[model samples]
Target chain A: MAKISVYRFLSAGCNGCDVEILECLVPRYKLADLGIEVVERPEEANVLILTGGVNVKGKEELLKTYETINPPKIVIAVGNCALTKEIFDKGYPMVGPPDQIIPVNYYVPGCPPRPQAIVKAVADILGVKIEEKEDYWLAPEGFRGKHEFDREKCMGCGTCAQVCTADAIDVIDGPDKRIVRVNYGHCSFCAVCQDECPTQAIRLTREYHLVTNNRQTTMVSNEVDLLSCSVCGGTFIPEKQIDWALKRITTEKVPAYSEFSNEILSAMKICMVCRRSIKNIREAKRLLTRLSEKVRGF
Target chain B: MPETVYIGPYRPQLVEPERFELLVEGNIIIDARLELGYMHRGIEKLFTTRTYAQNIALAERICGICSGIHTLCYAQTVERLMGIDVPERAKYLRCIYMELERLHSHYLWFGILAHSLHEHEAFLKIMGERERVQDLLEYLTGNRMNYLINTIGGVRRDITPEKAEKIRRTLKELKPLSDYIMSLLDDNGAFTKKTKGVGVLPRERALDVGAVGPTLRGSGIASDIRKEDPYAAYDKLDFQVIVERDGDVRAKALVRARETYESMKIIEQALDNLPPGDIVAKPGEPKVGEEVGRTEAPRGELVYYIRSNGTNIPERVKVRTPSYANNFAILEMLKGERLENARAVIESIDPCFACTDRVTIVDAKTGRRRIIALR
Candidate 1:
């Protein structure tokens, strides 16, 4: 293999991704052993490794650097910021994911991709084998990587979306179904979603190799059925959430709550607005009677 | 004729994007002016839009190398605003992580210095040691750079007994390597010759320029936030504040290198006296008020001023990173030095342009700004 020179451009986002790229040059990774050199100029380089997302000024600078590189050049966007702009996308000055401005050939995703992942990105593009130490940069036991969703365990309660550090999880409440989508591009791999999930429906699996050519395909989504209110006919809660709430009630030691479990389950079906509209005890009694009678038909 | 030389908006010497304009008469630099804000990402304005929990992640990204300290400072400030008392175990855990971060950061500085000095062998040795420190951090916190262990009321992670033991073993192994590196630095003629009398900042000028961290301490000032304010478990730990009187590039290097031992000692004490109990407190709702959280970051004093509006989100968050102060001192240090030593003096202060360049600077006389807004 000929000597491949790489020029790294540090853009506007945090410097975490650049630090990880430097890690590849350390003794363990031995980027020098692969006949790859980190050149000072883009003109001398065959590969351009860009870290961080570009801001307004950086976007202009990035384009100039891109034009300096010769043809037959490969551009690798490393880290979540470079791939999807991550948390900085909400900021005013940010104007990138790098691919929007220039044509990116490959994407290595992580808050900051591991050193081996970056080396793997370059090696994969050239179709070269990474010899020895197959488990060198393997994800550890508690490593936060790609988001994994369990459809059976999920109830679409949106707690993961609420606690997400990067606001990467989106809960779309449809008339019949609630769709919870986890966008890996915007994720920082903080695992706050997994920690706050009420049903343990989300997990950050130990699969850190998330590099891909397509940005749109880097998402995992789960859907659950939504139940409408009996009184107003408005979609309110997921059916699985109602079942989970009933299971919580049944596991309690109080016999009084369990004795009225049917009535409680029927009342849970009504949306808060309709239930609050009952002005008196007579109206509440009439609604409960009608709800119980309706519940029995099922 | 005095010529103007522009060093960068992009250069190999600087890690982040920053430019230096130098007025030089032949080989000597007469004056130096720094132009920054090229890497601004609007982090302070972004803080207002996110929830408190999300802000923790944002704070960590302010600077990647000293990430743990940023979160520690932010978390402590939020805790104060909410009037939450962190657990004893969490306090001690924070100290352990903070010192480990210092060791990692200082080693990284050494590696950069060595690389610029053309001591490739020393650079590799220091970076190898740094990698070990990062490996320990990764094993403990799951990430090498941005540990992400801090939360509003306490730490998100805990140090187990097995992990504590591993920390002790790693520090022990690192001691010999550090001593060998110190000897290499002391004996090498080329290393000492280039660094001995270069980039000299007198003690009075260092204080005048408002230098912080090792830059201030290297000039014989014993100012350290950990000693004066004592946030986290620093109050209970035993460690010395290393000081050097020379006020040169070598002085700052020596201060950082010697302080690594003090960091190791502090971590050992925190591990030995690790408290037993919960690692977190239930954070309460924010009461409307303003509070400041300050800590001794690896580079120097880091301050985060937070204003809460009786909600989950903060009304305002202002971060005063140590580099912001130390960067100004470079202008003073750069004066009257040879043009060749300019990069060394700048790197000596451990400038983090990403942390410093949060806003655009406009000259009062001309009323002009470098960055123009589009749309």
Candidate 2:
């Protein structure tokens, strides 16, 4: 059996992760029972456990420590910091994401991963396959993928942008050509944007699948426009929704409302006939009811 | 001869000049000199750039254990600056969260202190019971650590009657457990031996150094931010601030243990007298002005000074964390104590390294300056 040693490195990071790591070492989830030993020196350890992201001054020391450790050493980037650089990434002089600095063998993702997950990751890395059921309590709520906007449904209302605490949503194209753009990196999937959208245009898709070689592009979602009403010529419907239905049909690109001349506007559009018909039908129904009551009284 | 000692969260902690040259012929620490800053994150500098609303979130992230306290202070300071009134119900709800934070934080510190002192069984017992408070926090606020309930004017969530009932029942169940733990403090001779005479910070010295929370209360000073400043609905609720005259490790422990009981009682009272109304009031951004906000965190008084220049972003924000003040007394407490007792002496103050590491260190011998490291 190969001797495995783990050296946990934490620099200017929250102590909660370190405390939980200590708890894992205790009698309850004893890692020693599984041939894992925590060592004081990184050079002697077979596995390096990277905890906190590297802050300004700690960056050099972290790299130096990684260099001193022998080759064929497996690095396990633990927590959100080591994997994606959650909060600390925004801080000045940040040197986070172990993969950016060094090659990582495996990654355990979480604000602070549970002890069980850490244990499982370690077991899997050591060439042992262990199947475990997902814990629903640990799963994140709301959308984990890119944001989608239904353009046709959007009333050019900036409610989504206003309600977004993260400021990820932006109304880029002006009031006339209103287009909502979302920076997926800043979006926390809080669904505040979706809830605040007046027209029910913005929504979180159920797709959680994300993968990328570039960190910048990996987390962001691509934007798709909704389809508009052909008669009124309003791009109020999401482009995807219309495309899904009218993919087989031939449709010509209609001119924008501003582009239509007075002659073309009057000839091309039929204004509110359905709305007027509904109102007249309701009025006629009321008259007939009143007439029936008068005859009965006579 | 000046030896180097490493501090801060880094592995093989950064080595700093140690001016303390102890000539311990027997079992006494003859001399000690204070060394400062390896953990400074420039939080004050960073705050200058953040907006008033964004600053609230940033302030809360200062310390995970006392995140709620920081947010409360920040929100209050902004409200004061804007001259806006927080809803009556909001104040009561804030107090509930604040007290719950105190219960969990003190329990966490107790467990850590016990663990440092090598009382493994006691540490586990304390932490096991502490989870109930965390459970309450998770139930009340969505998250266990970062409870993002605070907004610019008031809180975001309201405590419904059904939720209040659940909180009351949990508090009732935990009351007996806290009492059982407190009983152990009286009979355990080992606990007394390790803490009673250790880390003695005299009342005058504590006051002179501007110690707050249990650190100050342990020194026989009846000073508490909740009592003195009376932010939120703390004034409405009837509760006594626990104090002890010993000014030692044991005194601090006793103050914390007693405060836990007082907190539970306050929670029970607040639950019964909870008012029915809106949890939050809509308010605009704060105009240009500076306002100081203070709140009693689990450790001590947390003060935030916010300055707005009539812009979306704040001109400057200065945070005086309780740990920053309480940590200054460490030099006085560690005097004439053994090296092994250093951890206990430090933990007794409930020093928040994240909060305290802001101070810059200047070398006495060379006048060279550097940040103090905290490990």
Candidate 3:
């Protein structure tokens, strides 16, 4: 029987992949139980398991290892970085895929592929198809293709807007009429916003349908009505989101009503333009007061 | 004449040196010269191009075992730059995940240490038990690995009452198993024989070399990032930093073993006092300045140096990983040790190759310089 040797390679990638690779080879998954052994040098290796994404500095060494390894050597590209350069491939100095940099026979995908998956990939490369029933215990329901926001369901309370990754969700129109718009392209479907939604308005449906024939249409936006003021009939948005804007527009400039009068407020159900006009009038009054005080001091 | 032992992927060849050297005598290795730069990846240079938000995910991929620590440090650094204050609840969550990561990382190291010592049964047993912790992490965070839980300002997810209950139940199951494992650490004679005094990294050497985490703790230098520089909710949690007096492989193992118990205690306390509030805090972009964020990773202290130019993208993102620093002490640890003890010694430091790949090696004898390979 030929002695089977394993060469675990990491290419300027995260150390977690290497640790997981070690996990696969160790007694937990026991790659050696099937007569596999980890060799220190690439020359003594029969199966080369390449972990991590190829960084600029590590590319030369990676190419050298691929060239040095003997023929009939099976290469397994493990983890998302190695398979597709996943997160790091955007603008990072990635050489290419593990197969592009070297001759790869098998590919396992995961942020860091589980030890079982890695072990399975190795076994498959060795021409030994180890059949194990797929465990469906932890699998989420549906063919969810990442996460997509139902713009209609979003309250635009800036809850999802606050936690969005793609900077996809933004609360425009100040806080009162704040709307959420998602850049679908930037969304990885991690569904963090959906999970953190206060009103349970943003939900990640199992529907994995996302299409982008044009860049302009990739962003999906939804507007929501803000909680209006009982007295002024104006949008009294969440205090938290509008604190920055409010700091610029002082309380004197903000339209106020005398004695919380709903009758006077009902007559002034005006849009933002009219509301700004009313606010300016209030500001002019405060400026007059300040000027009078200055004149008296003089 | 000393012969160079060439162990290549193609074939093994032994060639005599051009000069008659007294360094090598037959099979006995008088001096060993390591050849690195077989794998290199320019990850640091790449960070400059990525946005600060994007870099959090990117940094997490630097090392799988300590991905949580990497993301935590990155997030904390960005938060500091942005002048955002994380909620009390988020801090506790961060501590919980950090301790859980420490548990799994130490368990992983234990398995590796046992494997290197050829204690196959113990290795399998330790790893098989580690799956429980992984399950807990998976249950809390969506993914088992690369958990995108940490974000700028605060965490992305929150553990609810139901989830906390589940965690409590799981901890109950893990407690006895962990206690049993701790008992076995001292009782197992074979385990002691392989680790005891095999690799002795002195306390002063550990401090001078700037070793962090369990490696420094094992050397009796009580320098823990959690204790010294409290980040997340570590300051709130009640747990001791485990330290051992002897700077041997056994002491390192003992540090990790005791830390596992401490980690469990931290998780319990965090879950018990879990606060109810928003998990994330919304804040503006960071100002132009340099800020440092550090966390105690499973291996040691993982530090991230971030410089923001008042833009979404950072000007520079420099990571000083625990493994990267700890790996520097390897040559010193291996100086007087035999070739057979190399694997055990490496495992003792909980060497993280993913973290160590950033190191640039310069030859002392010659002016030749080489970068450590990732593979």
Candidate 4:
């Protein structure tokens, strides 16, 4: 039987990761049953579980801890903040992520990854076989995980970015076209994007094991073409949005829109600025025709 | 032989960073001083970059155990600044989550303190029971530790009858475990003797040191922010403040246990009286102004001050956690106690010091800089 001892050093991140670690030790998970013990001194520890993003003051202590442990020591970064610093990586007092200061052997990521994830990370390091994580616990029905966009369905109106609760989504509408960029590191897993998407293009999947030493691999960028305004030369609505508008105007069951002809259907493709001017000109012609008929009758 | 022993910068086996200097004479302590910092992440500074809608996620991360209340308290502060009217149904849902948080936090503290006293079985038992609450929270909010259920005007999620039934069932099942633990704490001589009169803070000293929540109530104050300045659906819930007069470690434990009972009661009443309506009231941009918001968290009275500069993002956000005020009170409680009794007495107050370590201190007597923490 292998005997292992660990020293828990939590730095600046939220206490969520710490709680999950404790949960693993409790009756349900029974992490202790795997021949692991928590030791008080660094010299006796074979593994160091670092559960937080290193803050300014924790920097010196962390370095000392890394040094105090005898060689052949393994360091594990336990949560999303410890892995990438997430959204709280900016501004004063934050030193950096754990790996930036000390070398890390493994990382388990989540806002607070379920206790199972921690167990898996530890077991892999110990070369012990453990069952895979229970997906339901890690992500309940609505728990946000990975951001996925269907390039075929996405019109790239930038509405997903506009409605995003976090600045995780960015929409760039230039002279050319539009694209929505998804920075997974900054995402809070709120899924406001899924709710606000008109084309049902964006989705948050239940693949919650997002731990990565490098964050660049998790990002997503989807591009789409934009339509030119019928009246002006500037790029207007997304091409897909024009089709959506045409379908809506033609398919309405209401009596007011039942008589819609090809003229009205094509007019829906025009930008709002041109649509308004055309409506004014048509009304002026109708008024002139009415006045001429009245004079001819006199 | 008065010697000052320094503890931490990187405390062993603790959940966060904290430093404490104890003045000891042999096996007895003569004086005590605490230095917080060591975990400050400048979260308050990070708030300026996020809009009011996204700030709840940051506020929820303030502390792991008291995650729900931080977001609830910040949401209140932002609501006050924006003058948003919360829906009636949202108020009751908020109350349910708040009480649930208190229940889980007390259980966590009880388990950790049990471990500190070297009673490993009791520690495992209490922590095991805490999972019931965690699972319930997960079912309701889709996350376990930080619920992140609150938005500026109201809550992000609503409770259905089925989920409410589950919570009620869990509470019913937990009542017996809570009772068993409380009874054990009251009768078990092995546990009580070490905790009973080891660190006695007089009622005056407790108030003078600015202790709040169960700590102050343990010293016979009977003061609670829920009753004093009611927020959410607390005004509707019929509950009493749990207090005791002994002012010792055991008294603090008893008060928290009783508060757990009261929290259970509050949750039941709130759910029973839950009104039907919208869960959130979408807030508009906040005007340039500052407002302080208050809530009774699991530990004590939590306060949040928010300043908005006529934009979606706030100009500043400051948090004053209950652990900060109660932390100073432990120093007075530790004066003249046995050196061995230090850990139990400090743990008894549920000193979640990591959440309140914002202020920087340069101690003249010890000539050492103390940085508490920002939970």
Q: Chain B TM-score, candidate 4?
A: 0.92
lDDT of 1 by residue, A15-45 (tens): 8787778667787776786788887666788
User: Where does candidate 4 stray beyond 4 Å?
Assistant: A125-127, A132-139, A150-153, A159-167, A170-181, A195-200, A211-214, A220-238, A241-298, B354-375
Give the whole-model CA lDDT for all candidates, comma-separated.
0.82, 0.64, 0.64, 0.77
Give each model a TM-score.
Answer: 0.92, 0.74, 0.69, 0.86
Ranking by DockQ: 1, 4, 3, 2
User: What count of clashes does model 4 give?
Assistant: 8
True contacts kept of 1: 0.55
Every model: Cα RMSD to truth: 5.5, 9.8, 10.0, 5.8
lDDT of 1: 0.82
Per-residue CA lDDT of candidate 2, range B137-188, in tens?
A: 6567654555667877788777888779888888887787677657756647
Instruction: Output the TM-score of candidate 3.
Output: 0.69
> CA lDDT of B145 in candidate 4?
78
lDDT of 3 by residue, B1-375 (tens): 333322121111110001111122333324434333223345577677666766676677666677888889989888989999999999999988888888888777777666667677887777777777876776677656677778888887688788888877877877775665566557466677677777788988988878888888989988888889998888888889888988888888888888878888999899898888888898677798999988888888888898878888788888887866876666567556644554466667876541221123334456354443322
Ranking by TM-score: 1, 4, 2, 3
- Please write out the lDDT profile of model 3 over residues A85-118, one tens digit for every residue: 6555554467766667666666665555556656
**Residue A189 lDDT in model 3?**
43
True contacts kept of each: 0.55, 0.04, 0.30, 0.67
